[model samples]
Every structure is written in C-alpha cells, then in structure tokens.
Target: MKVTSAIIAAMCLVSLNLGYGAFYVLWSIADQAAVARSEAGGGFDPSQLLPYGNVMWVLAQLLLLAILVLDVVAIVLAIATWAGRRNVGRAAPSMPTAAPGR
Candidate 1:
C-alpha cells in the first residue's frame, strides 16, 4: 500500500510537470505566432510560423498524451489499492473460536 501510494504521488507530480510543459510549449507557439504577425505588419500568416510552430504543437500534443497516460495509471493504482484493502478486510474475520473441552 505504501509503495502504491508513493507511486501514485510520483505519477501525479510527473503529470503536473508535463501539464506545465505543455502550457509552456503552447505559450511559446503563441509568442512565435505573435512575433510573426508583428513582422508581417499585423497580418498573421500561417506560413510565416511554419516549422517552429509545428514542432511545438507536436511536442505539446505528446506532453498531453503523456499526462493522460499518467492520469490513467494513477487512477488504476488507486482503484487497485482500494480493491486490495477491501479484499484484505473480507479475508480476515474476528469470529470467536470454541474453547477446548467446552
């Protein structure tokens, strides 16, 4: 249980970091677009952004996918932990035993 809890915590942290990374990547793409627009005299051209935006967009997508996978893993771990505890409870009983020569 402790191990599972630790793993879940770690996964949550990693997911958070990935989310931040995604946000940063998206922000970078926007910044680049804005720069391109300014360079083009306020007319935004999709072609002007080109490869940089494309690469950042791909990276953001990959980060989002990783975050999603981590979320699923954490959820599965939580459910498994809950189910394990439930099974342990069901496997143990506090019934009184018959005394010898009673």
Candidate 2:
C-alpha cells in the first residue's frame, strides 16, 4: 500500500513537471510567432518559422501527452490503493470482547 502510494505520488510530481515544460514550450512558440509577425512589418509569413516551429510544437504535444498518461496512471493506482485498503480492512479479523461482568 505504501509503495503504491509512493509510486502514485512520484507519477503526479512527474506529470506536474511535464505540464510546466509543455506550458513553457507553448509560450515560447507564441512569443516567437509574435516576434516574427512584428518583424514582417505588414505581411506575416508563417513559413519563415518553419522546421524549428514545427519541432517545438511537436515537443509540446508530446509533453502534454506524457502528462496525460502519467495522470491517468496515477489515478488508476490511487483507485487500486483505495480498493486494496478497503479489502484489507474488511478481511481483518476482530478480537473477541470479554463478558460485561467478567
């Protein structure tokens, strides 16, 4: 139970980091696009931001996917952990009590 909980926590942390990375990449891409537009001075040629822009976009998408997968795994593990605890509690044998006047 403890181990499962630990694993879930780790996955959540990793997911958070991935989320931050994805956000940063997306923000960078938008900033770059804005700069390109401003530099164009009237005609914004998106082609000017070709391969590099595509690569960054792909990277951001992958990071987002990773975050989604990690979060799903963490949620599954948490549910399993809860079920395991519930089963253990139900299966545990209670001690017998003494008579009231004993």
Which stretches of model 2 miss by more than 4 angstroms? 1-29, 32-40, 45-51, 92-102
TM-score of each candidate structure, all chains considered together? 0.56, 0.57
lDDT of 2 by residue, 1-102 (tens): 878878778876876886687677777877688667757777756555545766766777797787778778877987897788789857568899999998
Alpha-carbon lDDT, every model: 0.75, 0.75
Cα RMSD of predicted structure 2: 7.4
Q: Which residue pairs of candidate 1 clash? A: none
Clashes of each: 0, 0
- Report the lDDT tens digits of candidate 1 across residue range 1-102: 887878779877776976677687778877777666758766656565545766876777797787778778877987997798789857566799999999
Scored against the true structure, residue 4 in model 1 reaches a CA lDDT of 80
lDDT for model 1 comes to 0.75
